[model samples]
Target: MVAASAATCLVVTFVILTWALKDVPWRQIADGSLKPIVVLENANGTPLVRQGPYQGPYISYEQFPDTLINAVLSIEDRRFMDHIGVDPQGIVRALFRNIQAGSVVQGGSTITQQLIKLQYLDSDRTLKRKIQELVIAFWLEGKLGKEEILTRYLNSAYLGAGATGMSAAARIYFDKDVEDLNLPETALLAGLLRAPSQWNPIVNREGARQRTEVVLDAMVDNGKITHLQAGAAKSAFAKVNPTRPTPRSGSWFADWVAPQASEVSGSSPGSTTVRTTLVPRLQEIAEKTIADTLEKSGEAASVSQAALVAMTPEGAVVAMVGGRDYKASQFNRAVTAMRQPGSTFKLFVFYAALKAGLTLSDRVLDAPLDIKGWSPENSGGRYRGWVTLAEAFARSLNAASVALAQEVGLDNVIAAARELGIDAELTNTPSLALGTSEVNLLDLTAAYASVRLGKAPVEPWGIIDFKAADQPEAFRVGQQSPQPVDLSPYQSDLVDLLRLVVEKRTGRGADPGVFAAGKTGTSQNNRDAWFIGFTEPLVVGVWVGNDDDTPMKGVTGGAIPARIWRDFMRQALRNPGPDTMSDDSIAGKDNSPRSCNVSACSRAYRSFRPSDCTYQPYSGERRICER
Candidate 1:
């Protein structure tokens, strides 16, 4: 009777277990869907940066090395192949060990059982939870088979240092791939599963070495490898060292592009891929240029911070460096830090004057003068008497710039700057001519890029494409055409004057063999130095100074800033083509009027040169003039 009652109880238990198994979520179990993270790519389709914190790159079973698989199996589950799901012998032995120790010191969980608990069960340590884990483990073994279960286990396991699985572990620890891991590396990874943080080689190398030795011994004892192999692995483990983390090259650019990416890809919680306008080659060059320059000249000049921005004339940002080192500080000085533009401000003032019917031959006095009790003096307190606007600009003569600013209304100067994208607040003071107001390096660089484009005003853009797995094509993704502007007639002349600055004056240091034109800006007391220049295809701006706005050791814009600009531009112009022009182009004329006095002539000057003429402001009449 007792045997018959036991059989009936067993039948009831089996029926209940089968009924509970129906709610196991088989579809989700079959397709392991994990967290998705944002991935940023460069123009060449190389990963520039990763944004999301949770999920990492996924690797399939075929990509994992056999050594890694062997090491993991030997350490985590010796009877994995022989067991159906839960190992009864392991459980029995663990129960006895715990009973002797008077506590649960050891867990008898196989890899499959552990995976079941990780996915379905909570850490209650209750009898009910254990039964559920065992049931799910059996179901997983039956449904997924050994290889699929192992693959899921390998990918789902979390390693240390923000790594999720073998693939991420390989990258984070060794800067390598799973297939490339040596025996010691594989053993080190296997040791991490016991306690990821405690056994992480990067965190505790000595402790990790001891743990790796334990794994190597387990591999030998489990018959996965011979004792001779374990000994060789130990020797290799002693010589192994994990790769330390370093700042990535495009981190600053990535930060700047993240917001635009979010907008293009949608601000959802899941993973999105953002394709940026960054040219990896140019980005590398920009980062290296800043690092090399700072390593050499930073201490000597007392300049601890610098910023750079390079873009196409259409305003597609190709390269950007926010600071000397992103790890030291993430503050993107190029886009956020507003500093006195110094003589770079002169470009806008001259742009206004040229639009107001003033030619490069127009004269302004470099002698000391006062505007509203504000006396402006040229550098070194020396004056060149009366000089043409072209000569004054090339010399960066402050007094001449101030005089020219007064001739053209400050309102016009501000408007002209607005057209080129300088949106910073400017006081209507004579000091405005000397760039007394603050503007960010990015806006200032883009403003100069407008002149390079000649045909349109450039809106600076960083994102080229954005997408996610769900989307067909990227949103807000399209090629931008240049916006038509009224600078065509003056474009060649303006470039000529700028070319003279590079060829004969302050910007001479930035003169590369290619046709280059730019302006050098030195702020008051040497607090800021800037060089904004352009080749036919690229426009770049550079700024160097102290973060505290303190003055450097006489580091003028024409010196270190120009040298840095020249070095970067030389490398950028290495593959110059026929489309590129030489300095001789600066002498070519557009057959436009050399000067215009009437509003009609001024209007004509916007598109082509009207005949040269002088406007008699006092008499309200226009007169023809010769160059």
Candidate 2:
């Protein structure tokens, strides 16, 4: 037994010595080298934003408040001052607690070890990396006293909201210096060190409050603060308001593109310039329209959040509004939130039926429908007994849509949706015909873009190209065009259906006083509202609802969402770019007679001569030219 114990001790000592002899990054630590800076710009070369690991002013040890110091030590390392460098007691306690909880609920790294990691080592969770961390922690302790070590830790630790140190965090969160933070504020900052982005006070107030309460409780248990003090601190924390230092303009676009820029630049040593697909003017228009609409009618309609996305028919994302206010919350609803698309998903069903040999002039029943114990009804509890496919679609008759899906198999419907780039999970149930599946705004908008371009799918892109400082050549995305499914056979009929919606149905609210095509959607109990449409050159999507999936009071896709789309498109088209159609093209000046095909008329109605053909309101078939 003695021989085995001595052998184990010798092996452990030799491993420790080997790790201690490894080269320390003293020069890099002293110089404070960080990750490369990424500068994002719009398509027009206008700078959107720049992000880097910036270090703030150095604060002395004496500048830190007692409450701040105690709060951090209590939660992060309870035995920070008592242990030499690595605390075996803290490690054993953390391991036991983690085992009991069946998860990693606690960390055993001391302040010294964390500083060593921040300054000298990568964050790999390997046994060798941990031993090296411990060795470096001991070496650092030997070189500096506790006060100096704590000061450096406070100066180098990364807090949330682009802050790199306690000094920067104080200024970023409270708009004050480090010495001015009170007990509750200090506790909030300390709590952020664990998960900065998840509990950012400016973006997630409830998360921040809950984490701060945990820190206060720990302070009380550690005997650093009295129970009364902890209670008072909790009360004060509930009222704390943090400042938003990040820029609001184009922040959603910038945040979405920054990580992609870093990846495209690879591990290059210097900065990189990323030219993105964002159009600043269009982005501004989208943001203002959402804010104005929500401010005007959000509370009255019980809608607190909205997201918008606009992209060209070729799939370049020109503008995006993730939420009403990017500063209040950085959650990119346009790119992240998955909500039911409602009747907007019917587009896929109708397209599938068209491919199944059904024409727009074909008649279908719109009465009550029941399939496999599931009954679907129309909006007003009324229906046309038998109507043309165009009228049924324009009216958004759920019964007709479901029947069509049944006639052409659910697999075909799912295939149509998948062909249009909707990758959301879908079920093969009757409710699937009514868009019971959830999809994000970005992918839904991209799907519509494909329809507008006579293509089955269009992959949306943000970053156009990026150039690192040291590299001579730029890395470009979509240098080779992707092959999309050909949707030309049913393109005209699909356009006619969407146009009928705007001209004679639920999507009337979205008309921009010009030629356009789109569909309106309302989920169950009005929980999600959506309006996705397109003009000649642009496709835009809008969604309005609450974050908790609560229903809005009487809000539907045809109401606020369509109006928001209208306001934005109106402002966006005012410049008279490629979005506008000339008068001559609409009138058709040629004197020669030509047959007016209904599909061609619907697809090119903006350029179709009204004098060349007669009008038949109810008939889906085209009329012969009288000229």
Winning model by TM-score: 1
Deviating ranges (above 4 Å) for candidate 1: 1-35, 42-46, 49-55, 59-74, 77-106, 109-156, 177-188, 201-245, 264-270, 275-292, 365-369, 464-487, 571-627
Tell me each candidate's TM-score: 0.71, 0.60
Instruction: Give per-residue lDDT, candidate 2, residue 236.
Output: 89
lDDT on C-alpha atoms for all candidate structures: 0.77, 0.80
Q: RMSD in Å for candidate 1, one decimal? A: 13.9
- For 15-95, candidate 2 gives per-residue lDDT tens digits of 776775466676655444445556566676545542434344556688899999999999999898889899999999999
TM-score for candidate 2: 0.60
Backbone clash pairs in model 2 (N, Cα, C under 3 Å; residues 3+ apart or in different chains), count:
0
User: Which lDDT value does model 2 have at 2?
Assistant: 100
